[model samples]
Target: MFINFIWLNVFLMLCAWLWVSYNKRAGLVDVIWAFGIALNVILASLIFETAPLMVRVFLAVASGIWFLRLAWHLLRRYCHETEEDTRYANMRRAMGKYQHLGFLAFFLFQAGLIVLFSYPMLALLNIPMEQWGSSTIIYLVVAAIIMLVAFWGESLADEQLYRFKQNPENKAKTMDQGLWRYSRHPNYFFEWLHWFAYPIIGLAAGVYSLWIYPILMFLFLYYVTGIPFSEQQALQHRGDNYKDYQRRTSIFIPWQPKE
Candidate 1:
């Protein structure tokens, strides 16, 4: 059922992308629907078996809240956006006649990401949560704090970038203010960090999956649908300034800029 659910999304998104790729952008509606679907999958997973009811409930609430928040933020920002995400635009351009294949690859990759990071939610139903211990409590507390910090960082970074781009004078300029001053992609960093928190909570609840969280982060930051390809698009669009920014700024970590 889980695998089928995952593939259902992948197939639907792939089909949609084929028709919409040339005419429109991926919208917030789709993002919200995706989040809701993922949450539903996780919730359904909990009902099948495994884990103390309290533990499963707690993890489900935590994950559901986080996902909903992310979906809200993304939806609001993309509300008026008509442009294809630069990532998709560049992808379409580079692939040209092979854009259909590119769409399938990216669509499936996204579904895979949704499934991988969601392992904690799904895997819990396969393992008993009564195995939770004192050490797991510590991990959960620390993870909760990290969740706040990561989500906050992502929020501030996005707000700063948004405001910067709003100014006519800064329209053509590279953003180097606020969180952007510290990291080239603060939002992406937090997005990666977000996945770690879930696994920690899952671990705390005595729910474990084989490398699900780490693999999700690794692929998101390095390969498939992540930064390497993204940076290439940025370089082409932002010109040498983005290249200079890359040299001076941390690619994935948040820190004060060097003097």
Candidate 2:
């Protein structure tokens, strides 16, 4: 399973490389990154064929919805924007002559991340339904509730931000409305919540190590790729407005804004 996972990412990364080489838009890698995880879920279910049919189907549907929405949002942004995202553009400028190599490295790094995020799904799908026992019902209920809430929260956050951006009056202003008021990164908060659903489901299947999935996801979002970069970009673009938002709002977990 590990070998197949590596090979699948390698192929996906190669495709991303070719696409970026032709279009010179390295930002498309973000879209590819989402789809890669969706594909991983489907492939893992098919290749393993050990987990309960219902479990596999539910996972595929849940993850598919999440990734597809994310991918579509990113794809539209990529299509409409004339220039690369500032994040990748900055990386390109920093790399100078080694920009292409840097992008390749970035793509590969994201591919690894896809595999890492898929661990809980892989673990859950390997456990057979017969072994789930009575706790299975509890697990499924908890997982389903968490996943639904998290997905809905994320969608709402994205929608609120999108609508805010669409308004001319909101330009250069900090978003302190709706979910954004409670947390500076409500979207990331809910995204991290989504990972917990898997481990809860895995727990019912007697998979102990699945806790690592949410832990890794939290670390990645909090300390690595998610909040740090987003806040940096916000600070750069929105300046004092964003700083004020940061002063009053929670960074990851949603809470009432500070007084």
Candidate 3:
């Protein structure tokens, strides 16, 4: 099953490479990455065919909604924008003559990450319900609540940012209202929070190692792809305004802004 999943990701990476090569818009890979993981989870559940029907159904529904929403959000922005996203554009400039190769490597790296993060889902699907204890009910309740809150929070943050950007008056200004008042990347924080549900669910199923998914997610968001590049871009665009926002706002955690 794992081997087949790896091959699926390889195929996805190849397709993303080809598409980026043709479109020269490597940012679309984000949408592809979301759908790729959604597809992987659905496929894994079907191929395993041993997890409790309810568990598989819940996982599919929850993850499917999350990924589809994310894909649609990214696609809408991608269609509206005339240029590549700043992050990918910067990467292209940095890669210079080897931009294609660099992006292909990046696409493959995302593919690997998608598979690695799906470990919790894989673990959950393989655990038999017979192994679950009474305490599993508490974990399920907690996981469901966390997932709902994370999804809603992320959606709100995105909407707020979108609306803020849409206003011409807000140009060159920092968004320090709403959730952004608390965390510079409230959307990212909630996105990371969403992963907590998976590990908790996996724990309920007796798969403790599944905790690695959320931990790795935190590292990637906090250190790798999420905050650092975003801050750099913000600093480039907003300059002192963004710097002031950074000084006053939490970087990742939601907290009362310092006066």
Candidate 4:
């Protein structure tokens, strides 16, 4: 399969870090810290080795597209912005003398996560879950539709926020219109939703043994990088307005804002 071993993941992580470092953005890497995830985005395909040809193609293309999207989104988020992301500033200070150690630990753990998050890739990579039949086409079409929904949701959310940020008048306030009106973190919510398509299609194949795909995403959204990290940043930046937004808006699901 495309992802044979953890070594590939490690290599990918290092490459990401190297790219970040080359750009003099190692600090950004420390803060936004996206390299670890690229590995997950790619390694998820390791499971395709045993999957049906149709299933494998779907997984590979889905994952490839997903990674490209995420990579572009994050790069746009972090690149060219000189702000130290606040998240990394505290982390770097906390690391102190062992900051180098912190980067290593963070990168390695993210490598594992890349492995962890790519469960659909593992589930559908090489497993003969579906044959080239009507079922396969249905799976592909469904997956593609879900993927488009997910892609659009994320892209629109990011675009809206980017434009909001660009407007000089919107500074120091919370974004409570557009997609932001419904979900406190529209981009992140959709980012998690994107993972659902994989399993919807992966299960259509035959790999049900690994359920880590959905569970980890759920956990990540609530506990890890999703709400936890974003909320922390929001509290620091937006303060009371953000708190009100959180109280009125759905944390995970998309819905109308409180009237």
Worst 10 residues of 3 by lDDT: 128-137
lDDT of 2 at 176: 90
For residues 1-259, what per-residue lDDT tens digits would candidate 3 score against the true structure?
Answer: 6888888987988897898889888888888788887888887777776777767887888887887788788887777778888888889999999988888889889889878777778778888768766677687778889989999999999999988988989999999999999999999999999998888877766777767777888999999989998899899999999999999999999999999
Total residue pair clashes for candidate 1: 2
Model 4: per-residue Cα lDDT at residue 68 = 68
Q: Which regions of candidate 2 fall more than 4 Å away from where they truly are?
A: 128-130
The TM-score, computed over Cα atoms with residue i paired to residue i, of candidate 1 is: 0.78
Clashes of 2: 0
The per-model lDDT (C-alpha) reads 0.68, 0.84, 0.85, 0.68
Q: What TM-score does model 2 achieve against the real structure?
A: 0.93
- Which tens-of-lDDT digit does each residue in 1-259 have in candidate 4? 4455466767766765666545535544433234444444445554435556666566666667666666676777676577666666677788888866676677677667666655556645555543434576787788788788888998899889988887889988888888998988888788877777766665565545545666777787789866888888888888998889888998877998786
Q: Report, for all candidates in order, the number of backbone clashes.
A: 2, 0, 0, 15
Q: For model 1, how does the per-residue alpha-carbon lDDT over 1-259 read when each residue is reduced to its tens digit?
A: 6776677666656665665665656453347344754576456656666655554565666667667777776776676566877765676788889877766676767667666556566665556555666576577677778777877887788788877866888754788888888888898888777667766766665556644776667675767656887688777778887878887888777776766
Q: Which stretches of candidate 3 lie over 4 Å from their true place?
A: none
Tell me which of candidates 3 and 4 scores higher on lDDT.
3
Model 4: lDDT equals 0.68
> Residue 26 of candidate 1: its Cα lDDT?
49
